[model samples]
Target: MRIALFVTCLNDALFPQAGIATVTVLERLGHTVAFPAAQSCCGQMHANTGYAAPARQLERLTEDAFAGQDAIVSPSGSCVAHLRAHTALPVYELSELLVDVLGVTDVGATFPHRVTYHPTCHGLRMLRLGDRPTALLRAVRGLDLVDLPEPEQCCGFGGTFALKNAAVSGAMLADKCASAASTGAEYLAAADNSCLAHIGGGLARHPGAPKPIHYAEILAATGGIRE
Candidate 1:
């Protein structure tokens, strides 16, 4: 399958490795991944921040960027959920594409680490991606998948929400960081880097907190950590 990767703005700029790891995992599964150079932000930030006009424009731009493709996949569940709601494009979150569309779970990945997954708000509530990510994680050879207390709670990284409601966001993030740290996992994995960034920022202030990593990186691993 020729899949067009919509490396969202955040991943394209700050977390390029997540996009690369996504491509690595897909290619390792015998599928070709194409990155549409014209692809840019999915306007999730704009829309969520009450900038309707700009959000619509970015949505149109995204529609044009991936005009024609067998399928479109993005590493960020938040971005995918926004596009799915605004456009008719056939976009799927990585887990949705892998477990639902591609009909595979393992993806031949091997990551030996104690890890816990935090279901992002978009992936958990909007896309309803239940057990798909964990199913894939469980298949990884030598991976110890631990349970996160209150896994469904939002990590307080609702894009602009974190900035606008800094106090509330920080409070929520504190609870989330505590929950993730209590898992006794070396890594805290999530489908969306936006949340990981927020949770990771909060976790960094403490010692011995599990490192935040995108699940795609975990899936892309081959008995060794990528980067």
Candidate 2:
């Protein structure tokens, strides 16, 4: 498959590892992947913030990135979900495709510590990704997939909404972190880096709660870090 990597703006700046890990996972699976230079933000931030006009630019950029590709995949569920909500094609969530389409039960990554999943709003609600990530995590040899206290709650990092409403976002992060902490998981994993960044920023300010990690990192661990 000729796959294009959508290294989302947040992940490109804050968590390059997640994007790198995503490419690593896809390439390790014997698929061809491309990083289109024209790719930029998927415009979820603009769309969510009543700036749908600029989002069309994103659609243009993504359409360019997806040109002639067999499938388009990304580590960020929010972006993928946003596009899926708008268009129709073989675009897939990394976990959804990894488990359902790719048939990769074992990538050889080792995450011995227990971890809980925090599904982002657009990904969970819009994308409708249920427990497929957990199912794949449970299949890992030494992974301990702990139950998240509230599996369906938002991480309060609604892209630019977090900055637009920090107080409410903080409260939502507090609730999310408290629940994740209650699970005693070493990692708080999710599909979207944008929410993870907000949750992680909140956790950094809070007294407890582990920092958030991307599900792609776990999948990359199966093959271990490339660099």
Candidate 3:
């Protein structure tokens, strides 16, 4: 199966490893991955900030980016959710495509560390990816997946929400960081790096805090090495 990766703007700019890992994992599963370079922001930031016209324009541009792909997959559930509501094209989050479309969860990965998953607001509520990430993590050889104390809680990274409401966002992130720390997990994992960036920022302030890693990086791991 050939899959086109809708590498979102943020991933392209800051989290390219996630996109690379998505391609690696898909190739490991015997699927070809294509990068649609024409893709840009899905207008999520513009739409969320009340710029309707620009958002619509980006929607059209995004549609044109992967016009002919049979399958569109993104590592970001947030971006996928935003597009899924507007596009007629099929868009699947990494876990959704891997589990639902491909009918496989284990991507031949192994990470021997205790880890907890933070289900971002978009992935949790918008995409309703309940247990899909967890299920995939469970299938990873030698991985010990721990339950997040409050898995449903947001990491407070609602795009510009962190910038607009810094204090509130920081407080919420504090709570999330504490929860992840209590799990005794060495790694804090999530589907969205936007959330991980927020949570990981808080974790960075303290000594010996768990590092935040995207789920794709974990799934793309070969043996005990993380991408």
Candidate 4:
């Protein structure tokens, strides 16, 4: 499959490894991954923050970016959910593409670490990803997948919500961090780095917190080495 990777702005700027790991997993599966340089932010932030006009414009530009691809795949569920709602083009989150469209579970990965997954709101509520991510994790060669307490709880990183509702966001993040830490996992994985960034920022303040990681990075691992 010739897949166009929609590297979301957050991953492109701060979490490039997630994007790279996504491509790594796809190519390792014997599929061609294309990067459309014209792709930019899918305008999710703008739309969520009530700037509908600019959001619409950016959505159009994003649509044009991957105009003629077999499918558009993104590492971030938040952006994929936004684009899927706005555009007519086919957009799939990494897990969706791997499990539903491609009909493959084990991507020949090996990561020997205890890990827990936190389902982001967009992926859980909007995309309804369900167990696709966990199914893939379970297939990893040596990974120990632990159950996150309250796995469906939001991390309170609803884009601009973190900035606008600082106190509430912090309180929610503290609860999430506590839950993740309780699992005794070495890493906390999720599909959306936006939520990871928020949770990671909170986890970083404390010593001995589970390191935040994207699931793609785990899937891209070979011989127990993370990307």
Candidate 5:
């Protein structure tokens, strides 16, 4: 399969590892992963904040960036949700592509740490991808999937939410991080960097947080060990 990765701005800047892990896992699975140079933001921030005109302009640009591909895959479910709903192109969440579309599971990887998943607002409310990521995680060789206390809750980073409503966002993140910590999980992973970073900041503020991981990092565990 020829797959194109839409590395959103957040992943490119703050969480490049998720982008790397995404490429690593896809190539390891025998698919050609192309990082489109033209790809950029899907205008989610603008749309979420009620800035219609710029959001639509940016969305059109995003469509042009991902114009042709067997399938466009994104590590962030929020972005993928945008493509899935607002754009005409076929889009897939990384986990949904691996577990549902491609029919490839058990990624031949091992992650021996207990981990919980944080479903971001866009992924859960926008995409409604229930149990799909969890199912894929469970199929990994040595993964121990734990039930997040409130798996469906948002971590409160709605793109600009953390910056705009720091106090409210921080409080919500505290609750999410506390839930992840209570699970005794080594990692609190999610598909969205915006949320993961918000939760991670809360962890950094607190004494001992499990620290959030991008789901792709766990999926790409073996170093691709390189060919």
Candidate 6:
């Protein structure tokens, strides 16, 4: 299958490894992956903040970026969920692609870490990716997957929501960090890095907190760093 990797702007700039890991996993599965240089933000920020015009324009550009690919896959569930709102093309978040389209779990990965999974709002609700990610995590040879308390709750990193409601965002994030820490896990794993960053930031203020790792990174692993 011809696949295009929609490395979202944040991943391209801030979390390049996640994108790379995504490609690594796909290639390992024997599918060719393409990187379209014209790809950019899915304009979710603009749309969520009441700027419809630019978001529409960006949505068009995103469609154009991956136009003609068999399937456009992204390491980010949030971005894929946003684009699916308007774009006609088939866009699959990594886990969705792996479990639904590719029909594979385990992906020949191993990460010997006690980990907890956080289902991001978009992936959990918009994509309805129930058990897909956890299934993959459980299939991993040495990874320990633990249930997150109130897994449906948002991580307070709803893009601009954190900026607009700083106090409320912080409180929500604090609760998320506490729940993640209570599991006694070495790493907090989630499909969306944005949520991880927010929750991880709160954990960072405290010593010895479980750092958040992108799930793609774990899936791409083959004896590399656990975190």
The per-model lDDT (C-alpha) reads 0.91, 0.78, 0.90, 0.93, 0.81, 0.89
On TM-score, the stronger of 2 and 5 is 5
* Better-scoring candidate (TM-score), 4 or 5: 4
Clashes of each: 0, 3, 0, 0, 0, 0
Query: Which residue ranges in model 3 land beyond 4 Å of their true spot?
Result: none
List model 3 lDDT by residue over 121-171, tens digit each.
999999999999999999998899999898787777788888999999888
Give lDDT tens digits, candidate 1, residues 6-111: 9899998999999999999989888898888888888888898789999999999999989878799999998999999999899999999999899999888888
Q: Residue by residue across 1-227, what tens digits does model 5's lDDT show?
A: 66898888889988888888888888888888888798778887788889989989888988888777878888999888876777897788888888777888767677877788887777788777787888878876777888889878778777776788989987888788789888888788888887887788888776666867888888888532211
Write out the backbone clash pairs for model 1. Answer: none
Candidate 3's error at 223, in angstroms? 2.2
Off by over 4 Å in 6: 224-227
TM-scores of all candidate predictions against the true structure: 0.97, 0.90, 0.98, 0.98, 0.92, 0.97
Query: Among all windows of ten consecutive residues in candidate 6, which has the lowest summed lDDT?
Result: 218-227
Of 1 and 6, the candidate ranking higher by lDDT: 1
Scored against the true structure, residue 45 in model 6 reaches a CA lDDT of: 82
How does model 6 fare in lDDT?
0.89
lDDT of 4 by residue, 1-227 (tens): 66999989989999999999999999998998999999999998899888999999999999899898889999999899999998887999999999999999999999999999999999999999999999999999989999999988899888888999999998999999999999999999999998998999999988888999999999999987777
Candidate 5 minimal-lDDT segment of 10 residues: 218-227
Least accurate stretch of 10 residues (summed lDDT) in model 3? 150-159
Residue-wise C-alpha lDDT for candidate 6, range 50-166, written one tens digit per residue: 999999999999988888998999988988888888789899999889999999997999888888999999988998999999999898878888888888889898988899999
Candidate 1 residues lying further than 4 Å off, grouped into runs, are none
Report each candidate's C-alpha RMSD, comma-separated, in the order given.
1.0, 2.1, 0.9, 0.9, 2.2, 1.2
Task: Kindly list the per-residue Cα lDDT of model 2 for residues 95-196, writing each as its tens digit.
Answer: 877877787767667677688888788667877778777776776667788888877877777767678898988788889988888888878888887778
